[model samples]
Target chain A: MSTTLTPKSSPIDSPDLRAWKSASGGGDTSQPPGLLSGAFLQETLAMTRRLFIQLQRRPSTLVAGVIQPLIWLFLFGALFQNVPQGLFGESSNYGQFLAAGIIVFTAFGGALNAGLPVMFDREFGFLNRFLVAPLASRYSIVVASAIFIAALSIVQTAAVITLSAFLGAGWPDPLGLALVVLILLTLVLGVTALSLGLTFALPGHIELIAVIFVTNLPLLFASTALVPLDFMPGWLQVVASLNPLTYAIEPIRYLYLHPDWSLGSVVLQSPWGSISLGVCLAVLIGFCAIALLAIQPLLRRRIA
Target chain B: MPPAVLIEKLKKSYGSVEAVKDVSLTIQPGEIFGLLGPNGAGKTTTIRCLCTLASPDSGNIEINGTSVVDDPKVARQSLGYIAQEVALDPVLTGRELLQLQADIYHIPRKVSRDRIPQMIDLLELTDWADKKTGTYSGGLKKRLDLALGLLHQPEVLVLDEPTVGLDIETRSAVWQFLRQLKAAGTTVLITSHYLEEVDALADRVAIIDNGVVIAAGTPNELKDRIGGDRITLRIREFTPDDEARSAQEMLARLPFVQEVIINSAQGNSLNLVVEPQSDALLSVQQSLKEAGLSTFGISQSRPSLDDVYLAATGRTLMDAELAAVGTRNLKKERKEAMKGT
Candidate 1:
């Protein structure tokens, strides 16, 4: 808590002078300061603040992130607008049914790109700046990125929810809206973890970008994001149900359509078995835990 | 008292290429030590080990009495490293970047608020403090990096090629700043391929070649050990080989002249190393004039650090750098650098 502004003196004028006289000389040289909880928290918050400031100054990424999904919502809904009533099931129109899928997909897509900046940091050698510092914990790098991505996901989710209501897909009940937020948070956390892991493991940003390009769209189509599992062939249904995005989408969809639902209510009927709402939540949590655990070795090698 | 930095028998190999075979050095407190080598001669590798950024295969690196291998976190706190390449987040202002650096070192908020501006003033960065680093010129960025490295008041500051590519004015400014840091009782370690840079800055120097320390001493000590005055003589601007050989033979007979060789690369000029205090230049000119050969140009000087390098390695630093460029695996080297602690 002691703060002193020692006047800057040229070393030539006072050859024997020691800068930081109190901290650098004499007492208590045995201990390092970065290990304390307060110190670690201060570092993590500062790093996270830098990311937010960047986002604020460069608003294009956020604007494009929100706008791209809305564009998809309008285009995709109009494409299926003429389909026979009730054919897509339960909703008044295609736009109503399609809004849930687009919300989940948009959040999932944005989270998948979280590693691009980290990968760029690695290539540009900015990561070395962090490595040399006496940081309390290297996990702060991961924590900072997670916080940035989560905030972006929330803003995008709100945009889609508001737009969906305008497009005649009535608002979900308060409890249902809360469930949507929980589902988005869990999915974003897991995906962000995986993306950050790839950033460290891949040799360069080009390779990481290639992997993102290959993985993004295929995972979306294979899941129940755009179409229900029942609409696909039997084998395709099995694949769709196995995809993690489906687990996230189906619960939110069930929440929007069935406000009186309980945890015991079956949310998804997969080829393997019927999954209740509780089991879906458990699956998403487990997916996140596994993703976090999977990146441990990679992070250790780069951060330790 | 413990040395400010100690590195012994350090070795690091990338795949089949042995980058650093064996290197050992000790830097005294408050002294400026220079690690001199060609581009790929392991200077960077040795510094990397000392900073705890890379682990050596088999060696000891201690900073301020703390073993970097055994307790890197403590050693890291004692040292501030400025990498050769300046890496800055384009979006952050110079001041914001320093704040991030303060956080990483765990400098208390109160201390950071007071110390940050002092560092900015010390480095003469006030005019550019509020501008985003992306718009900064190369010299400005390097200065900002120095400020960040010194913000914690580290006991030892390590810089890898501090002025590799800078305008003359900026380079001199950096040199002046480093000397000030040393005067304040901060030990400084610098690595450079430029012979004059090391000559001008280091209190002691270790000359490395092919991943090994071939010679180590103060500049004067090394020059004195090689003990001789050198004279370069050219009969004509581009002398014939026979004439150069005859001149070499004639100069070899003089009692004060120790050795002579025809340097074919420089127009077949004759290079001579003579005993100190010997009027070797006048004798060579007189001998050449008697032989009906006109003196094109002649010069005499004491042995330099380059002469010491030439004596130990049998190759000039420029030649070594050219050879290294041909053999270097740039991609592999970058990947190796990226491999963390």
Candidate 2:
């Protein structure tokens, strides 16, 4: 490939290369890096830092994530403040029952919207920057999103819990609170996986937003978040019982009412049968596994 | 020892549109290779395949002897791609963005601690390094992008239109930086539609038209191979259609004149190919005087890369570029979607 050049067309004079050569690693490897390799963690942390920097510059997403559910808590709590005695069949006020529902739904809502940043990255050509890099795994992209969304969910969950506690909804014991956090995290993981999947499945942000809008409200109303299954008619009761949020909500509500809660204790009387706390945990884990597995082929096809 | 970059018989299509019909290139180490083509001539598609942004229907691409198709991770480690449009996250400061790039490339913290400063100084971005990229000017953004591309010091650096829309100073800075890269033993590949850009920097170039290479050689070799000294003469400034046609006929009849084309886009000036090192210009002027034609102006020089393009494709690069602009990026978007990650 070499061609001779006359002196008149000789190469130009240049600066020294010590700096560039000094910093050069260029660690070229034939094998793809493993999922949890140091390279993977490095890239994932870098990406997560970028997202956080953006959030720091523009704190509206985090602010809204914390505040939007509080608005729901206040508005709905006051609207249902007049529910007669024995209607809920639990603690005194609607706020007490609503707190668990709000915490779970808050985490779920935030997780569902995790794909927007990725979708924006796609449309704006920023994602192509990562796509062309020598990433260990494209799942680093998914994992980064998971980390950012998970952090936001924690902040939002804490906000909801604190606000609900102040609104006459008593706090669960330390163990009960830990269980509540575990449930919310599991639910967040499954929903976030689905959201990232949709980031690749759909064409652009507009369509993803449409799907989010179509999804956000119906899930909340269908689950036991706003009302118990028995409060609904027969058909609505069936839909509410089948909802995943119902599984999450009933377990947390049981923790609040039963001081000595156990995994074997029946937390929910679903239309199917008596669902124990352990069974609910198993279902959430299964959902999360299926979601993570289902998006693998899609992510591989998209970026791997 | 192997070629720095190799692409053989690459073919890719988007549905019925064949973006790359067949392209083969072998770039030696420590040389600057330029891919010159008008927009939509498959320059970017060929680049996309090389950079692992898109898979070709059939081809082989190797970077520093690693097959990009079979083992892209290693190939990616050896290739650095600087895209045409700046893709920085505006919210992040330039230093932060550079740091992010280094991390993603897995540059160790100890090296990057010094590496990032060297890059900032190289691009003369030290003052602007700590400012948010959203506040950067177009030239600053492009400079930062160049720094990011060079941070890891890949074996080959590929830039897609490194300076299509830049001020003269920035363009010169970029050209100088590329020269410095070559001096440091890095193979450089740039895709550009600018004739002078290719001529000025490329050690060798492939001129593509409509998804295939029509000509490939050193710029001087291509001009010499076409075998003519070009002359541009106008019968009159803003010559009328009839006058330009008559002048073209008169010039073509000359013993030294090989070809003549009326350039209506340039005030109907007549472009001519004449015998090299001959008194073709003087003879043509004498003939025009006998024909009672007024010579507005006339000049002669060695054929430029644009002339080479005109000879190969039967159209000027500007004309092809203008036509491409009319089609808009709608088709480009469709092609990008067909890449189908």
Q: Write the per-residue lDDT of candidate 2 for residues A41-149, one digit (tens) a residue.
A: 9999999999899999999988888898899888989899999867885867898888888888888888898889888877777787787789998888878887888
Model 2, docking class: acceptable
Model 1 DockQ reads 0.33
Kindly report which residue stretches of model 2 are placed more than 4 angstroms away from their true locations once superposed. Answer: A1-14, A22-24, A27-31, A233-238, A302-304, B235-243, B286-296, B328-339
**Clash pairs (backbone) in predicted model 1:** none
Residue B139 local lDDT, model 2: 82
The lDDT leader among the candidates is 2
Would you give me the overall lDDT of model 2? 0.84
* lDDT, candidate 1, A1-304, per-residue tens: 1111122433334533344433433112356544347767877788889989899899998999999889999999999989999777677888878888898898888788888998887788788777777767666777778778878888988888899899888788998888888888888889988998888787777888999999999999998888878888998898898899998988888887887988889988899889999899999999988998898777655321
- TM-scores, all candidates, are 0.91, 0.93
Each prediction's RMSD to truth: 4.3, 4.4
